[model samples]
Target: MSETTHTAATTRASGPGRLLVAVYALFAVAATGRSTVQILTRFEEAPLAYSLSALAAAVYIAATVALARSGHTSRRVALAACTFELVGVVAVGLFTLLVPEAFPDDTVWSLFGIGYGFVPLVLPVLGLLWLGRSHPRTPDAASSAPPSHRG
Candidate 1:
């Protein structure tokens, strides 16, 4: 007889999350590659933008792994990364638009990810939703417990 052990190790990345992971992983690779080339060859041209790209790449990489791992700690990491990604994209987008001079060169989030079909701008939103839905409800913590008799 085969034995099956059920645990919180299972992740949402199996279903629709599979698509999410694919997207995040793709962005991670793309951003990492882009930032590395920009920073290595032309750091003086746009240090801020290149650095931001590197940060975004790191966040994407973290989020991808966390979401795919699908555990308590992993979920928290994914949530934080998604939140930061959203904030970064919005902040960078606004800054680039409000003052074009602020960014000497384009980062992954420039123009709200216009260069990447806006996937970068929208990915975090989906990730957050997936994380929320993936949250594990304790099996014996709340509803399963007997109701306490109130005085």
Candidate 2:
């Protein structure tokens, strides 16, 4: 592949992108554990909430893997995962607030992830911003720029 394409594919996994991937991985483990215990022990207590936690876990896992890989497909997957995570957290937060009775037990996304210090709410935003900022310029765009003189 071309240098620009290679850079675009690999850039997301380097520098600040590494920290983003680490955070995503951490969330994936936390959510997975929480959801697993909730589902195995008291799924009937708050089925919707537990299920949402499971879904959040899956999204986090996907985001972590996608962000750590180098490829066009990985970039797309990461973007989609981050977008879905943002939407899910907001929707779940609102639902739990407006309908308090619907969730006797809190999930990872309840109240915009208040349980996890709001990381769930903020993580996706950060991921999206990082992705946007790290995206590589296309070759045509790069070629149109003035040459640099570093002598």
Candidate 3:
């Protein structure tokens, strides 16, 4: 493989990205555990909230693996994960604020991740920024693409 491809293949799980991946991994585990216990025990209490927690757990797991994975495909997957997370957290956070009665219990995105010190709110932003820096673009993509001169 070419050097550029090698560089492109370098994972976001490197250097500071390693820390990001670690945080993602931690959230994955925590969310999985929380969701599993909640669903297995009292899913009837607040199905929506518990289900959202389960969804968050899945998202976190996907993000963790995507960030840790190599190649452009993984980066794209990570990008999608981050975008979903950003939207989910924002929408859920706002929903909780506007309709407090809707939740009846907290999900990972409740109050902008207040239960998790807002990490859920900030993580996707950071992930997007990291993706911008780490994700590979082909020569035909981005500003690196050849500019056309229209006569």
For 17-95, candidate 3 gives per-residue lDDT tens digits of: 9999999999999999999999999999889999999999999999999888886678889899999999999999999
Q: lDDT per prediction? A: 0.87, 0.92, 0.89
Residue 12 miss distance in model 1 (angstroms): 1.2
Q: What is the TM-score of each candidate against the true structure?
A: 0.87, 0.90, 0.88
Q: Which segments of candidate 3 are over 4 A away from where they belong?
A: 137-151
The Cα error of candidate 3 at residue 145, in Å, is 12
Off by over 4 Å in 1: 1-11, 139-142, 146-151
Best by TM-score: 2
TM-score result, candidate 2 = 0.90
Give the lDDT ranking, best first.
Answer: 2, 3, 1
Q: Ten residues in a row with the worst lDDT in model 3?
A: 3-12
Residue 145 of model 3: what lDDT? Answer: 69
Query: How far does residue 30 in candidate 3 sit from its true spot (Å)?
Result: 0.3
The prediction achieving the highest lDDT against the true structure is 2
lDDT (tens digit, per residue) of candidate 1 on 1-151: 1111123335576778888999999999999999999999999998999999999999999999988884567878999999999999999999999999978999999989988998888999999988777666556677778999999
